[model samples]
Target chain A: MAGDGTGGGSQVVLVTGGYDHTIKLWQAHSGVCLRTMQHPDSQVNGLEISPNGQMVAACGYQHIRMYDLASANPDPVITFEGITKNVSRVGFQKNGSWMYTGGEDCTARIWDPRAPPQTRCQKIFQVQAPVNAVMLHPDQSQIMVGDQSGIIHMWDLKTDQNDQLVPEAEASIQDIAIDPAGKMMAAVNNKGNCYVWALGGQAHPVPRKHIAAHHKYALRCKFSRDSTMLVTTSGDCSAKVWRTSDWTPMRELRHETQRWVWDAAFSIDSRFLFTGSSDSYARLWDVERGTLEREYCGHQKAITALAFKDQAV
Target chain B: MEVRPPEKQKSLLAEQLENCPNLPHRQYLEYAKFDGTAQMGLPTKSFKIFMTMLPEKHQNYPLVVCVIANAKIKDLIGFTCYKYSIEHPEISLGSVHDYGLCIAEDDGEVDWAFPCLDSNEPCSKFGFTCLGLIELKYKTVCAAPIPMPEDGIAFHMFPKAADSGQSHQNTSRHNTGGSQTSEAVISAIRAVNEDKKKSGDVNLEKIQSHIMATEAPQYKVYKVYLLRKVRTNTPVQLGVSLDRIEVEPLVTHKHAFWQSRSKYFLHSIDSVAWCQVLETRGNRTTFRIIYSPSHNAAYSDKNISGNTSFFHPNSTYKVHDFECEHDMAKEIVEKVNTILDLRNSPCRREYKTAKEKKSQTRRSFHTKHLS
Candidate 1:
């Protein structure tokens, strides 16, 4: 993606990783594959670009690797090790002073990237089951963690306190997303239901509503930068966009060969959507017209995870 | 049975129409009257209304129009679309099984017709009945109600000759001779009433049996955007009847008014190498058919002249893509495959399941107005 602050002037940096154990960088507008970095040890479970857009942190089994985005190097500059199982998700704090990750090790950990490798672990929030997803509120004061047992643990950074709730009885939580405004939060589960929460300054986050977004397993949910649209991808080979006003479906992004859309991201403007599918292709679609604008080919296997940074730094 | 609009009093809409009386047929077809016979067009008001139903920006872009109709249900219905200011008559299709409308004859002969809305005017080529089961979007309810029949209804189109007195005489004679053969039982197709039994609903099963009774070939023409062109309009029509294959691009110039000429390729069932329907992320499904042209003698009578670039007529095979609702891709695939089976050509390359959307029908749109 041309907007990744990486190509020097806040150009997009689109990187996709999957079971194929390779990460690919793409020129978002032209559908061109820019670079391919190999993850020979294990498949990349998740990918996140630094807030500065100068580095991409890839989540893998027992390790998290950080690669330089400003240079052409294909090797990882730093590998955060000492994790016991598959690192399910990875993300950076707003200022890049620290990073947060959730893993099958049944814990969500905060790491200070500037610390020595042995003492990089800053704090850990342990749960009964594996953590599948974690999202930081835009205020950067709290982290929302979703686990395999359907429990969501809200960890407050400033107070060092935690609160937990179960949105469903048995359905595993797949992903969680907080809207850019920090006023609402959305979480998806294996049952294809999405639960939203209205966040208040000091009060408990109130349950807003639950949407039956898909008939099959829901994989991911993302809120647009403007906080007006919510997009959900599912194993049903579809990604649906919903208007935030009344939660009515806006458009469905689909291509004939596209199957099991695993990850999707809204461009900085929210007028275009980029999706990675199980068919080894990533596509750019016009959000308003619901038409395909471009297709990025060349992945050897399904692209299960993608990180896109298009904002100008 | 007599079924009419209950207590029909002309509404304000009728009075508005009366103030602007329709243009006479002679004045409407005047531009090309000297160049042999003229094609019948829609009344100016109806044409404007029809154009308004289409997308405003792409009004002049290439379009694929398809219609289906039956002869027994005779309310005069047809289409008129403009081509750079030169208006042209539209094609209406009919038939369920074989008899009502067939693209090719029982013997494999291809005779395409460009039908008209006016029953008095002679149609192009030889006379032919229209195919049944077309959407009634542009149907004009002004023509005299059709008097029903015994065996089946007769939707006859007069064809050939100039604006000579003899052509008119031949048409009325054909119309009367055609209607007299069947019993004079009136089965009206339009103007329904509150009484269910009194209102004439054109039974679909009966039309099916009527068509199957003839064992004839039937076809349909669809209006769509083909070849990504922005100017010339096209209608790719194909019909299935017997074990035969044919391809002809029929070009009919309604107004012989334009200085430049265009070529229209009519793709028959035989010319199609494959049929595919791939449902995209959206609610609509897309129909894709590969048309490979053959330089055979049967296609010579089709419309062709200058500016072949519109469709790239010289290309080996061109792909025509159009968005159709209602499981159209599956229907087209099955129909095309039946003929391909006869030819022993292996074509279906993708999983019909992968390409087809799970749902056969389009989902309803929830717009702001509905919300």
Candidate 2:
């Protein structure tokens, strides 16, 4: 990790962004913001901390910006432009060799981030509707892309083959997640429903469970690092944790002023979770106790995306 | 190169045509081109556009929105009040041209005028604006109460696979004692008859009437919403009457005196009915109301006077009951209304007549309102 400290395995880093047009890095344990980077171009659409913890990638309207984590630079070290619409989601491959993004342009793209002057989007997978979320499985072979047409497209990177599934015809797929173990996958949609599938040795994912996770539109779903729990956030102003064993609700994390929760991330230990909400605050909660543990308050507006990396467990 | 079957080739061509059509029409109803008015309103200032679905039951649900932003002041103007059908999600937003709400400026001066969020229809694609400029955007994460109540009970019945098997469990709630009162039983019977019709099956009214005829005379007062299929602005008053299990609509007929005696019959004049789900197939679900009119008969020794007509025909009205799947059935039921005004109900008059009889006989008497 290329941060301020020497090679320490126990070092932790947290980053978040939103409508305030700024990205803030935090000390995960202390909740103190260490640095603030101005993202004045557009409100942050998605955020991802690099696998090695040396950089941060923030996707916005039409640009994907990369900032060096160790440097106090006020400007992005690399910026990829010319995207036709909002770049809704961005994430790095496990080895940080390339980056993947889904956007309103109805495409999920692979970009060669290592290309310094020109970040060339290497490949594009077109779909029928605007793309909302993109996730790479832990196996590092399949990319899951979800779109506003309520379709989830699975692209096999090795074979260059793809398949699609429409969980609900009328609901737009908002977010998707796969467990760290790569044994299961969960997706939440605009209709407040969550669908889970069991991943096997074969290519086809078996349908496991369907949960009505919220009353209104569901914005995000994430699996805990340990894979024992899943969390879904919605417009109803609450985040619910579900046990992976039975898919039953575990706890409801709610705050009076938290209008809409936009994003969430699990700590490396899977014992804690951090959420960014439209209430303009990033909150940490003990997943087991379902209690608010800490609040990282600095953004002047709603926090739309967040990323966290903790000491390797 | 690989060889393919003729059918496969045809399907591949069809898919290509679907993706690269020469002509295209609007796929979504909420399409509105941003005419640079929003850009001009706040050319330099940046503001976040946060959106959340207004709960269905909220009284101030905005249907037709007229967002007036002060371009010069760079401030938001609040939404206005209006009436709209929450049921119309597929309708185009531009179809309705009313922006009736007034923007009440609070606490200060204002400048330029601009409209935003004016689309009355629901949208699937919340497009993003340019990089770093004050542009329209969608919130990425949403928070809510866990196990959202609106998540609508998994209703696990996927029409085809579970069509006949164990699907009875879905109707178990209607059979429970709490929901099986006379009114519910009547509506249930009617609903079954209508459900049968949708499946293109014969009406079950014959079997229903037979079952109702076998039951002993156990008349009970039942209260039900009477939605009249007429040109009335509102539903009639809640109907309180003797309930029967028959699936036939109540028909009332008025006639003159006969054989020096009085007579009245149930004819298809105006009666109240209750709404219930009738069928669900693919994306469509149908609802229906069964109309049953009550009859008041009188008799004398000179000659029995009353019209006894069996197998009278009653009408059934159907409506589309499908909304977004997340919405509960209860929400659909709430939209069905009462047709009669409460002031016109016969309960007060019946009480007066019963009171006069009690005064003459000096006996303890009681009256009950089913609702």
Candidate 3:
């Protein structure tokens, strides 16, 4: 009876935003909007929580703003305004020493979070086209940069050597994900195709499986925290979870009215999942039962980006 | 009894979770492979190091450190630290205890003595025995600590005779046998070569890789200078501001790569301007050009007009600085462009939503050449 509450009764921090131009912090158990912060400038493109859970970063058109999670300050404490074009991804290093971001500017950048406003970006990895997604591998040494050009660049932070691979020709790489075990990698393209690779200690990742996840454009693909499941959301108005043991379909979460699913985040235990959709509501679904557990209903516009940092393992 | 089709057996829940909600291997042991590797000369005097979770109050995240006996203990040889994410635990952590190489002293023992005055109480009071110090052999990814120690203690290295084929073949083999010894040797040599050289540094010439022997210069953090031209009635007077950005790049690519390019050069004229080397007389460097007159046209063609609010034709300045700080300058330019972009592409009805833009991009993606 101790774990009877919603979201497995874990202490979770959930932040969601989108076209509403507002970011709402939610209480995971009750689905209540604990606080609302006005973005005001532009629709949030991507959101992330710092490794320490003290700050929440939201990336929009040409700007990355960091809100204080420990306090009730509505205004952003640290604002990165100078990034040109739309920033599609924002993430922090495991130790919180630096942050990494990718944007439509055709580059992935590393920035020191403690530095002053003028001097933040410390390193830059240039790609051929506008980058769609940027991810840090669990090994913490390599950064996965996925661009609209369909090329995924594996940049080694220790050696600064970059290796590139093209999964499909003319297919824009929308998102890239490496499992927590560092054993598998998944990349979803705009063509609604998902490519999986079994990674080794070597530089290149070998192609494992190709899943036609969605009929329409695929928006995002993420691996569960346990590395047991892979969830892919698409414009086809459904989110499909695949078992990692075998590339077999486990469940397809769909709603009649949901137009497009933009983003998804898994709970700490990997038993629950939270997804933000174009319907202007973020819903939590039980992964095992494939059922809707709670609905966070406050945003007036589409929920495009969300960041959830659940209880530490 | 009729057998179910292979497809029909695919259930709603995962195969392992369908019958029993709790997984059988909730906390499974990720074994280390010592196969193929001859344990002939492997050090046998290992200890039971206690690792306890560091409190949330003392640290930002939960980090467990192995507590080893001090250098004074005769039985103490050397120890390694292993870390895995508590949330997303790896199924099989190939190697349990392996980090940088520890060169042995004259007594045939590698002494690892790190300062533990502050760590003593935390380990004894709250730490638990998470892992044991054992000889492991496997192919695994290892993490290199950032901001490495400035000076490391140098010990007399163990002779290479112990790793010879003759010695490994004579030893009794265990079940944990595999082709893993060569990898450990490779990593140990890498650690030795990666050691920074100092006055008292012990030369690891025998174990060093030939590639590392070429001596690539280590990366260094440099101070940036913001040079601006002043027009105070007289000719353009040079003004150097010391409160500039901080950049850390390898010495080889020091002056050419700036992580932030917008802060120092205009995107349109960046190619033409950076090619020209300004006068560098006695540390007094002339300004290149960091700020451009307007946002690039590639960005303006999306939805709205150019960002005319922040850009003025006459306000562009020349920036002359190191390439390390050039990226920082690009960040500044990006910030300026964002402010200007807000003026033209505000959060209004005229601007398209993300969904619309995504759809448009998808339509145009087919015609676009892949990079």
Candidate 4:
């Protein structure tokens, strides 16, 4: 389970299914299992939290689902299942009312939670190759979709328009983030370089800094709640913390198992970092001292997805 | 008196001195012969006075022995004669040993002017003229003066003559010498003194200027603005300025016989909303504002107030409008201006207001400025 850095007022825990095909939720700090939900047919690949933290979205093989925490026994209240292959990543609107999902089918679809099921599964974007990652703007007005071709395309959700494709990396773009301030965005590539782009004022996204964020293929990249720090995990089995100042590496935590660290998240207070690795375990570390604080073990196979909820339920 | 041969002139001058009485004749003869080269011609009256005053040894060796006794004497006499002649150029002389001992005892007037060998100008100095004539005559009569090995006459006498004051001045006029002038020496001393004075004054001025320009206490200002969506009664106005705001131009669509103009505004606001402001001016204005996100409520309130304003808890009315003249303009300009004004005000005056002091301490930590 992954918890956000928004603090103890409300905390969100997101867990993805491994080979078991069952996704579970537990208290972020206490490790108490809250609920367990089953996916349809395939294992869960990715999970995400909307900016408002009111809803949790999950993607599995060929299916996309969103669960509203406000409801009891909240099953997949909204389901999109037209993809030819398993879904890889998913993102939600800032308001938590809509979500976009990408999959191995080489297409990205936008879903409206308010729309009836018959009209909800809408294909908003399609690519030549399978989509691997997706990120939504903090304002919920634009969506950035990345595919296997290493190309990132920005789509204006409000205008129903597609912007010019941004050449992000020579290799596949694995993960992307728009900072809390919405002033900057960071994208990690398969080659381990994190490219940051400044938004607004300019007609196109301009690269602000290129950071050698990881030693091996970077699996996930995320910004802190305050946007002062960036955390990234890599196949090199280490998680690194980078300060925006000079884009210098500030801290690093290496796991003894040497498994590919698939994803990482910062706690709401920015005091702790959690990593989900291929070893089927999630480890929590002190952000400042780089000390391992706790480890949670339960997933039957490689832990592929992680997301954090700041508000406590 | 008898005329002496050119070579025997020294002996002849000594012999004639034997009959001198007024002065020591042998002494006179010794003085003249010691000079080595004797000139012809002796005055008779001066020679008689010289014989009567002769001492016993001078009387016995008046002629031949006098030459030997006075060998060293000539050098002393030559030096004195050279000095006097150069200083008093009006005196003149014909030759050494002329007028014999009579010339030594009786102070006879001598015209010292002698023609210079190089310029053919008459040299009137008694001593310098005699020396010059001796040098010229020696060069003609002999190979040259056989300078002493211990003290070379060429190194001492000839070089000294070439380096004399007049010779130096003449070389300087032609710009051929390196000797410095008195005026150059004086100016160099003055320049060194002036430089010392200037450096002392410059250092003092620099210190005074630094003290005068010492930095005053400084502060930062953060401006917060509010934005709301249209239509809902419960407008949720977030107390933060939009990161980027753009107002689109009004566009008219013509369909059939009807035309409608629509103006749309776009604002992008981030999650965080805080700005830093100086302590002084922050007290005069409210720090926070409440806004209802519903467009209908905001429009109705804006219409009633006849201005764009946000809700402030402390104000009498629900709405607080900034003193801006433009009705349609956004609150960004007002918020930014307030922040600038607050930051520019003095820190001490700002402390007098309780509200300003509280907000100032809340935003930033007060610490000494470091350079």
Pick out the ten consecutive residues of candidate 2 chain B with the lowest summed lDDT. B23-32
Worst 10 residues of 1 chain B by lDDT: B37-46
Taking the tens digit of each residue's C-alpha lDDT, what string does model 1 give over B289-317? 67554422244345362333243444255
TM-score of each: 0.46, 0.46, 0.46, 0.43
lDDT for position B70 in model 3: 28
CAPRI tier for the interface of model 3: incorrect
Deviation from native of the Cα of residue B201 in model 3, angstroms: 58
Per-model DockQ: 0.01, 0.01, 0.02, 0.00
Instruction: Please give the CA lDDT of all the candidate structures.
Output: 0.56, 0.54, 0.54, 0.47
lDDT of 4 by residue, A1-313 (tens): 1111121123345454455455555445423234445554776778887667666677887778776554333245556655678888887765666678877888778888666556776656877777888887776677888777888878776677787555454588888887766777888888898888887667578889888787689888888766778988899888889897678888888866749888787766566677887776666666777766545444545777777664321
RMSD in Å for all candidates: 24.7, 30.5, 25.3, 49.6
Q: Per-residue alpha-carbon lDDT of model 4 for B28-113, expressed as tens digits?
A: 21122122111111110000111112122222111101111122323323322332222222222222321112121112111123
DockQ of 3: 0.02
Candidate 4 Cα misplacement greater than 4 A, ranges: A1-16, A50-54, A68-75, A165-169, B1-371
Off by over 4 Å in 3: A1-10, B1-371
Top lDDT prediction, candidate number = 1
- Whole-model lDDT, candidate 1? 0.56
Per-residue error for B84 in candidate 2, Å, reads 54
Docking level for model 4 = incorrect
Count of clashes in candidate 2: 32
User: Which tens-of-lDDT digit does each residue in A133-161 have in candidate 1?
Assistant: 99987778888999999999999889989
